[model samples]
Every structure is written in structure tokens, then in C-alpha cells.
Target: MMITSYADSALSLLPPVVAIVLAVVTRKVLLSLGLGIIAGVILLTDFSFTGAASHLVSTVTSLVWDDGALNAWNLQIIGFLVVLGVITALITVSGSARAFADWAHQRIRNKRDAKLMTMFLGCVVFIDDYFNSIVVGSIARPITDRYHISRAKLAYLLDSTAAPVCVISPVSSWGAYIIALIGGILTAHGFADTGHLSVFLQMVPMNFYAIFALLLLLCVAIFGLDIGPMRQHERNAQKGELFDESKGLPPGATADLPEADTGKIMGLFLPIFVLVAATIYFMVSTGADALAGEGLPFSVLGAFENTEVSESLFYGSLVGLVVTIALTMQQKISTSMMFTGIKVGAKSMLPAIYILLFAWTIASVIGELETGKYMASLATGNIPFALLPAVLFLLAGLTAFSTGTSWGTFGIMLPIAADMAMGSDSTMMLPMLAAVLSGAVFGDHCSPISDTTILSSTGASCHHLDHVMTQLPYAIIVAVISIVGYTVLGFSGSVAMGFITCSVLFVLAILGLKIATK
Candidate 1:
């Protein structure tokens, strides 16, 4: 129902490719993304400098007041990030996180246990990736540092769980978004009875990358399978050196304020527990109403299907922030001190906010350029049916990597995935859909410009480039396994056997890597 200004052409790929290349080469993430936006604007304006400048102004301005900025989903997510930042700051300044670290110090005794504990925390916060990365990094850094765990390792743990876990969780923000996208496509194609949530559940078993990534993370954590740059980083960490001095730590690393040791772990435990409970409550109640409004009988799963994930997350984060502030106040902290913490916390999110704006704007520009449609074209024609899922996986991975945005890649590829499967056997549909999801997350997991990657670095206080470099080898290993798994599934046409085959292979791969690294 939207009009695209540009015809589907090869030029649509240039903007994101330039952005990716520049980010990798320059190591200036913000600058690289900004240049990509400019390139996209120039392309959209027919290659006129004056036109591009004018269009850039209009587009950037509109993000503040119109489509990108005024969008309800966008606002909800933005509010959640700001409030989450404030809550993180409040806990840090109030010494709540420090108290929790002290409380955990006894339970998590060794370096391996510390890493495992961080991984557990990451898995627990599956409601939203943004929330997961920020909360886990903020809370676990002190604990990890106490055990000589490197910032790179912490970033990997944070990044690995943030997106991969959300993509698989049935009630998380990511699940809601994917359901909405897939539902719309299915409804349009006359599959009105094919519930999107049902399809999502079916695809969960086939989500190879997400499943394998978590398994691999567990292997790395429990077995200490440090390889490539991560091994060097871990070696440095054991010597009480967390980061390479030449690269320097990220700005605002001071967010981990010095602890006062009040020993009130409630400051940390209460806020997080409340955040999870509140988010679940909002998702259920909001989703219940949405389903009832449509006159559908409200099953528990149906309620989640209709929930407003972003709005619920915003409310949940806001409530959590309020509770954390009140807890800090009870510690006899001055009003000015609490407000100062809020300001510092909000300011900390500015870098992430900046990248998100440019990323969203570039995605909008790509949509207008019909980039997805152009890529979809490549999947058409007489291709071998047995290799379709594998091919689509690589294509989706490349698209997500180039753009540094998984949601954008999903939006672009999901329809094509569905359409291709529609022409063939219906059994292929879920695998194809799963492939798109897996591939998008795989690419996002590795991309330096990805918002989750940036947040992971910010949370862990690791250099952004170090996180990407260390995580890439791990991500690639899982990606290769997924590609082969999907290819075999496509040919065999057996989801159950495919699941067993991939699961066994994933385990074997992890064990092999663990031994190899040792």
C-alpha cells in the first residue's frame, strides 16, 4: 500500500554496502553510518548534491516529527531505552549493583562461574534485546571484573544472548514483531486461518542459528573455549588487564561508579524482578485486550500474539525506573544526587540513540529504494528447490550484514521467503521463514554498526571493534553449521529429522571446537 520512488535496481545495495565497508575500515561507527545515510539521500535525490542536502534536512527533520520519530513503536522503544539508562544509573550511583555483586561474589566463586552467571543473567532478560544488553552488562561487569573476565568476553556474552534469545522467546518484543510481519503476509495470501503465532512456534525448532548460538555460548562459558582474538583477550584478562590500552575504553565507562557497599542487594534484585514481572503483566493484559477487541477468544498464547511489545516494554521500563529511584531515595540519597544520576544515565544512552536514528533513517531510505524487492528478484527464476532455504539464508545474512540492521532485513526478506515457499510445497514455508530469521540475527550478531552490538559494547565497556572482532569467529562457526543444516532440511523435507540432525551436529561442533581451542 506504499509507493516506492525508485525502481528495483542494483544501486539500492550501494548505500548499505558503503556503510558496512566504511565502518569496518574507519572504526568510526557513527561517522560511517552518517555517510551511508548521505549516500542513500543522494541516490534518492537523483544524484544531485543540492537536492541531497535538502532531502537530508527533510528526512532528518521528519524523523523527529513524522514517520520515524512520531511512530508509536519508535517512541515506545526510545522511551524504554532512556528510562532503562536512568534505572541503570540510579542503581550504580546508589550502589545497588555493587551490593548485588557482593551478594553474588560468594555464590559465583571462580572465573568460570562468573562467566556462567553472566550468561544466565543474559538468558533471563529475554523480554527485549535492548533491556537485556543494558541490564546484564550493568549488573555483571563488576562481578566479571572481580574474576578477571575480560570486557570482550562480557560483551560477547551480552551480545550473544540479547538478540538470539529474544528471537526465540515466544512472548518477547522480537516475537511480536515477527508475528506481525508474518501474519500480515499470510493474511494477504489467503491463509487467514493460519495463525501467525502457530507458525512462529513451528519455526522455533528450525531456528538453527539462535539455538546453536546459545549452545555455543554455553560451551564457551562452561568449557572456557576461547579462540582467536577472544583467547588473547582472555589471556590479558587473567593478568588484571581487561582491554588493550591502545584501543582505549568506550566513553562513559565510568557508569560503573565506585561502590559504597551499603550491602542492600534489594536495590538490584527488586528493580529487575519488578521489571520482568511488570513487562509480562503488560504484555498479557495489553495482548488480552487486543484479542478481545477483535472478538477472538483469549487463549494465553493468543493474548501474547496480540500484545503491543514496544508499548509494554516502555511501561515496564518506566515502572522499573520509578521503583529503582524510590529505592535509592530510601537509602537517604539527596534529591539532587538522584536527579544527577538520571541525567548521567540518560546522557549515556546518547551514543546508542544517535546510531538508532541513523539506522532507522537509512532503513526508511532503503525501503523507498525498493532494496528488498531488488533482492527478492535474485531469488526468483529456476533455482533448485532443495537449495532454496540455504540460498535464502546466505542472501538474508548478506543483506543484514550490509545494512547492520536485522529488523530491516526481516522486513525485506520475510515476504520473499513466504512467496517462494508458497509456489512450492507448503512444508518449505516454515523452514524458509526460520532461515530468514536465523540469517538476520547471524549477520546482526557480527555487524559493528548493529545497535545491539553497540549497546553490548556500551554495556560491557569494551571497545566496539574488539567486541566485533572477537565475536566474529564464533558467529561464523554457527552460521556455517546452520547453512548446512538448512540445506539438508530443504532436500529431506523432514522437520523432525532435520531438528535431530542439526542438534547432534551442533553438539559435535561445539565439542570439537572446545577440544581444538584447548
Candidate 2:
């Protein structure tokens, strides 16, 4: 029953394949993930039904309790989500969201302006994707709704901006994580003198997908370009159907809750401002604490590299919830009504919480299966130097898509990419690494089981499947252009040429979509 024995085998890929296929066909995320977990456990237990059941129980419990202690990271993230949900509910019940929407309606005259505002918020909240996805969606949803923009489209805006922005920002959590990993890779490859932050910054321009995805999102928002399933959603939104009601209410939805007429814009803006400020403060403080413990000097980058993201998020959200509750009370809302908001808010998050739990569990199982290892192995043994970047991008994308995690993909593929470049083409190291970063983001962006994707849908109050299906074509288009960029970089050895290629292709793709839709 040692799963490592099958790490390099084709069998390692089965669980995610089954899960993804079932999700696409059935549109039942829990069912797909549940079956996927069963599939993984079955593989681990060597087809022993009893062993599989036991393993499954242990895996589920392990999320909360692992290694004789509570799993603080996972629990804190869950806590953050719950608290944020409550804050969202309080905001809605106090009529702050409605007030802000009404206020914006007078200034922002159309769907394009509403979406552009969402995109702008998404970029500004670049500290963490989780924060960006949820907060931006909450802030923008009412305005977008008033402008007749589809929930799915709003989710797309939230998602396309969240990870893509975070992954590139040096001050963000994703940047810290990636930079630390790059430092290790550089050390291992005997480039210890090189600055990790510099390398990350260099990779920023080389991250074709992230750059182009953001551009594409801007185009979609400003030019009103809708592609594939997105077109249908936008059309429906124009007809006053923002989302398919048959799919049930999405997470963070407050439509059924009563709104107080006394609500003010400060009710929404103040709590959100507090949440953002508190989260950033905690991030720097925690990072500084960790650095001090290590006998190191305090620096912004170093602190970010050592910050506990989930813990910081949880603490900040708790503060945000407190402020929201106080604001609601100021509106003279009854205790019973406040409790109702709390209950409904917490309940609304259950679906996202459940999906995230299942995703984390299955991701763990996939790790044991060595799904990433097997996928990484395929990229070895004599790939053309000219195609290395493209191949690595594709491979990393595939690994991330299958595993539902970009961080996991980075851990697995970054080292391998370093080794590959060191062995045959030393000059390609940074580009190859950049390609992995782009690919990992691309894959995670598209994967239905990805936590960010789930949160994006939850934040926008859109059906998860609707968000996934609508966003896929757009992600793929950007990815394709990114592949071409990597390929050009691999061959031409010019970063500018590669980026230029992606930018040109991106513009063409957007224009073509604009024309075709017409």
C-alpha cells in the first residue's frame, strides 16, 4: 500500500483525471471531488475496500488534526472565510452594499465602468489573492449587478486579476513564496550570490500569461468582449438574469436578506478599509517577528518571506467582522436581525468551505500519488533547447491543472527546471523558471478544483461551474499566446521579442474576438 511505489507510474494521474472529467460532465463539485478522493484512497490502499475507507477517514480528519496537533494553517483559512462571510452578510443586511451600489449608479453609467472598477480594485488589493478575490467581488458585485453584468463575468474579472496580480507583486504573499523557492533553487545551482528578489522581478516581464491575462481582462472589461459561454451569460445579464437561479444561490449572496434603509457608504467602505489595512499590518508585523526570531534585520521583503498568510488573514478578518457588526448596530438593526445575518453569512460559506476542504484533501492525496513527480519526469531526457521553455510551461500547466495547486507545481517543477537548464542550457534557467511560474498560474486559473477558482465564484455569487466554463476559453487563449512567447524566447534568446510576440498575439486575439462577437 506504499503509494510512492506508483509515483512514477501512469496510475498516479487517474484520480485527478477522474475528478476533472466528472466535474465537467456532472457539474457537481462535491460529488466529483468525493469520487476523486475515493479513487485516490483506492489506489493508495491497493484496492482494499476496508483500507480505502479507513484512509479516507484519516485524510478528512487530518485537515483539522495532523501530527498530534491541530492544523492551524488550514483551520485559520477556514476561520478567515467564515468571518469574511459574516462581514459580507452584515454589510448586506445593514444596506451598505446597496447604498454603495446606489451611490455608484449615479456616477458609473454603464457596465464597462462597473467592470473597470472591479478590475482596478482587483489590482490594488494585490497583497493576497484570497483577499483580492473576495473583497473585490463583494465591493463590485452590487455595482456590476446594477449595470446588468453577469455574475459569471464578474467572477472572471475577480479571478483573472487575483492570482495574476499577486504572482507578480514582490510585496505579496505569492511573491514571497516564489522568491524563497527561487533562492533555494539558485543556491542549489551554485548561483548563491544572485538576488532572489531580482530574479523574481526579472521573471515578471517573462511571465507572459500573467501579463497577457491581465491585459485580456482589461480588454474584456473596457471593450465589452465576450467569448464562448461568457457571451451567453452576458446576454442573459442584459435580459435581467444575472445568474441561473436553478443552480441555487452562490456563496456570499445576500439577495434574500433584508436591507436597512439607514445604511451608509461608510458601512461598506470603512469595514473594507479596516480589513485591508489590518491584514497588511499583520503581514508585516508577523514577518518582522519571524525575522527577529531568526536574528535577522527587519526588511519588507524578508518579513513577507516569513509571514504566516493564513494566520494574518484570519486575524484581519476577525477585526473586519467586529467593525462590520458595530456598523450594523449603528444602523439600529435588531439583535435578532444581526444574528440572522451572522447565521446566514456563516451558512453561505459552507459550500465554499466544503469545496476547499475537499480540494485540499484531494491535493494531499495527489501528492502521495506523486502525480507531480510523474508529470515532471516526462519532461526529462533530451527536450530540444528551443522548446524547453514552452515544454516546461506546458508541463507545469498540466501538473498544476491536475493537482489544483500552483504552489505545489512550483515546488515540484522549479527544481527540475533548474536542473534541466543547468545540465544543457544554463542561459535558459530564468526563462524556464518564468515559464513554470506562468504555466502554474495558467493551470491553476483553469482548474475547477482550484481553491482560488472556488473563492472567485463564491465572491461573485456565481455558480462555480458557470465561472469555470466561462473563464476557460479566456485562460486558454492567454495560455496559447504565452506558449508562443516562451517558444520565441527559447529560440530567439530575446526577452523583449518574446514579450512583444505575446503582446501582439494578445491584441490580435482580443480584436478578433471583438470582431467575431459582432
Candidate 3:
């Protein structure tokens, strides 16, 4: 049955609002998302119970098998997650994690150093947010654990860095996607002479939220600036509690993995190096193949624009898994123990996989409801030109927060923002576009159903809600600062002034938090 869109109606907002409220209240992500999906289907089916049931089944089936074939992108991401889990398990069982921890302990003497290292690693792995989210956590977790850093804090560092870094980096998957969109938007607006890359580069400086968020992360790491629930988590960690025991281990984490005494640091470091190297190689290779298929010449930027990120991640992770297995064998781990690691690792990812599946399904339902479209529509008409950047930022943030997909929010809001800018003052285009990018990342950081948010918690072995609750205050602080920055830019027409204002405000905010907390 074909479902009609509720995009023109206020009811379009109901599903996501329900989902967000329930997720917060119940602290059951899957249940919240399931009900949200059902709620959307009911609205689409005019409250027919049987119709809602059938629609739900069809919607889920379509996620796995779309357009008469398997949904390769979704499946590949799932494959990568499982493979990464196995790699993590293998390293733990082989004692590579312990060895790496011992090595790190020698160098990283305090929580501050451990956090700064995690932030540094996160910035270094800016190729893709998903890869960064998990890989950085896998490598840095041992060090942070050794320093008694709370899992929530580690997850915050990972989550805050992942999207903020990706959204701003020119060579990253997020950048490629956004540049492609901007190219089309520019041409459509009769700015065919303007280079898309140039516009993207200029906009990078104007992306207040992303820059401020990263700076705030640095301040938190350097100054031990913990506020809100995060401070409690940090206090608990100092008392030898890294997480709430009642919440259980995070998905894709196992507490009982046997650590071998003979584990070497190379066992961990080698596999991770291979993972990053192989993934970058595959990303470029696949991108080049795509360029060739399109009868276009190869360039690094072009390859990135054409690359299949999920496919590259899957292949790279598979290679990493093979290397990990070989290293485990060399360490003389028992065959039975290795097999147990495989089983445990694969099984551990199920909860996360389930949550992701539900999140995707609800996202799809919300799409059908035209939730983002409705939200984006609100930003249209009769707006003062100076306030355009700040308005777009808020709208994009709301759309992404409701949908739980920054990319989806980008798709929905970028064209609308472009049209608005073209219709008004073309001079405000780059700043407006930058605001959309910044807001999407900010919103994704706060969203419980966001994939990066989920993976960050999994990577740090923290309860998903614990990560969400702890990170909310920090995200809000950055977002508020971003809004003020954009407002200043809009009124002053100076990107530098706006950024300087944001920076000053951010420093003051950090200092204020430190003093208040003290």
C-alpha cells in the first residue's frame, strides 16, 4: 500500500517527538524507536492495525532488500561492525590490549594526557566518522581505562570528535558528499563559474559549531572541565567506577575475555595500522574505479566524491580481521579460545545491530512522514537576510535531531538553504551553508539514535544512554555558542569576527564552568 505524506500537516512532527521523548523517559532505545515506527505507520495507514503491521514488515524488509536486490550499503556497514567487533575481541584475548595499555601507561601518566591523546587520535583519523568512532575508541580505551577515565568521558571525546572533524575535513567522506551537493546547488543558482571546492573551503571557516565543539573538547581535555552528568561520571571514575554496573556492558563489549600473558604491543598496533591503511587504500581504489566507470579522469578529490564508503570500510575491516587472526595465532592462543573469541565478538554486536536496525527503520518511517521536509519548510519565507545563517542552523539542527541522520538532514536542508540564499543575498550563501553543516553535526552529537552516537558508546563500552545524557550539556553549550557566532556573523558580515567572538565565548564558558564546578 502506498502511503501519503503528512508533510503539510503538523502531525508530521509527532513520530520523532514521540520517539525522542520515550527514548529519554524509558531509556530503552529499541522500544522507543519501534513505537515511533508504529506510530508513523498508523498515521500513514489511517490507524488501521493490520495495515500498520503490514507496512512495518514491508518497510523492514525493504531495508535489507531494496529495489529487487540486497541493500549493499546497509549490509556492508553491519558487516564492518561485526568484523570490527571480532578484531577488538581478538586483540583483547591475545593480550595485545593489555600490552598496549602497559605501554601507554608508561607514557600517559594522567587522565588529562589520556584524554588529550584520545582527542589527538580522533583528529588524526578524520577519513570517516564511523571508522574514527570505533577505531579511536579501540586504541584509546585501554589507555583511558588505565588512567581511570570514565567510559562516558571516553565516548564523549570520540563522539564529539567524529562528526565535527569529518564535517570540516576536505578529504573526508562527509566533505565529499557535501561538496557534491554544493556543486549542484551552485550550478542551479547560476554560479556555474564558482568552484565547489573553493566555496566548501571558505565555508569551513564559517562553520562555527564544528570549530567551537572541537575547541570545547580540547578545553575539556586540557582543563578537566566536566559539567552536568559528565562530572558525576568523572567523579565516579575517580572512585573506581567507570560506568554504572546496573546498566550492563555496552553492546560489542565483553568483560570476561581471557588475556594472554605473552601478548605484545605489536599484536594490537599492527592490526590497527593495517586497518587504517587498508581502509584508506580501498577508499581511494574504489573511488578511482567509480571515476573510470564514469569516464572521468582520476583525482584524489574526484575519487573521494565517487567512493563507496561502506564498501571500503567492510573490505578494510575484513583485512584487519585476517591480520588480527594471524597475530593471535602467532601469540599461541588456543584454537578453542580463538573460536570462543569469535563467537563472543560476533554475539556481542547483536544488541548494537538491533538498535541500528530499529533506528534505520524509524528513520525510514520518518522520511515517509516527510518529517525533515516539514521541518525544513518552516525555515522558508519572510526571514530577515541577516538572520538567515542562524535560522538555517537551528532548522538543520532540529531536522537532524528529529531524524537521527546528519546526512539525511543535509540532503533535506542544503538545497532549501541554497534556494533561500540565492533568493535573498547570494553573499550570505557560504555562511548559511556552513551553518547547516555545523548544525547537523551538533544535532547528531545530541541524538540518541544517531549511528555515530551509538557506535561511540559501543567503542567505549559505555551504556548508550549514559553517553547521551553526559554529552547533552556539552553539545548544548557549543550549540548555543554557535548560534551567537552565526548571529554575529550575520549582523557584522565578518567571519573572522564571528569566529573570534565564538572563541572568546567558548574560553569564558570553559573558565566559568571550571569556577562554578570548583
Clashes of each: 0, 0, 0
Scored by CA lDDT, what does every candidate get? Answer: 0.82, 0.92, 0.90
**lDDT leader:** 2
Across 1-518, the per-residue lDDT of candidate 2 in tens digits comes to: 24545565799999999999999999999999999989998988888899989999999899999999999999999999889889988998898989999999999998889999999999999999998999898899889999899999999999999999999999999999999999999998899999888889988999999999999999889888898999999999999999988888877676688788888999999999999999999999999999999999999999999999999999999899889988898889988889989999999898899999999999989988999999999899678889999999999999999999999999999999999999988988999999999999999999998999999999998988899999999999999999999999999998999999998898789879989888
TM-score, prediction 3: 0.98
| Segments in model 1 whose C-alpha atoms lie over 4 Å from true places | 1-7, 67-72, 184-196, 244-252, 255-258, 292-300, 335-340
The order of the candidates by TM-score, greatest first, is: 2, 3, 1
Residue 500 of model 3 has an lDDT of 94
* Candidate 1 clashing pairs, residues 3+ apart or interchain: none
Q: The CA-based lDDT of model 3 is what?
A: 0.90
Q: Summing lDDT over every window of 10 consecutive residues in candidate 1, give the lowest-scoring window.
A: 251-260
> Candidates' TM-scores?
0.91, 0.98, 0.98
Q: Superposing all C-alpha atoms, what RMSD in Å does each candidate have to the true structure? A: 2.8, 1.1, 1.2
Error of 2 at 38 (Å): 0.5
User: Which pairs clash (backbone N, Cα, C closer than 3 Å) in model 3?
Assistant: none
Which has the higher lDDT value, candidate number 1 or candidate number 3?
3
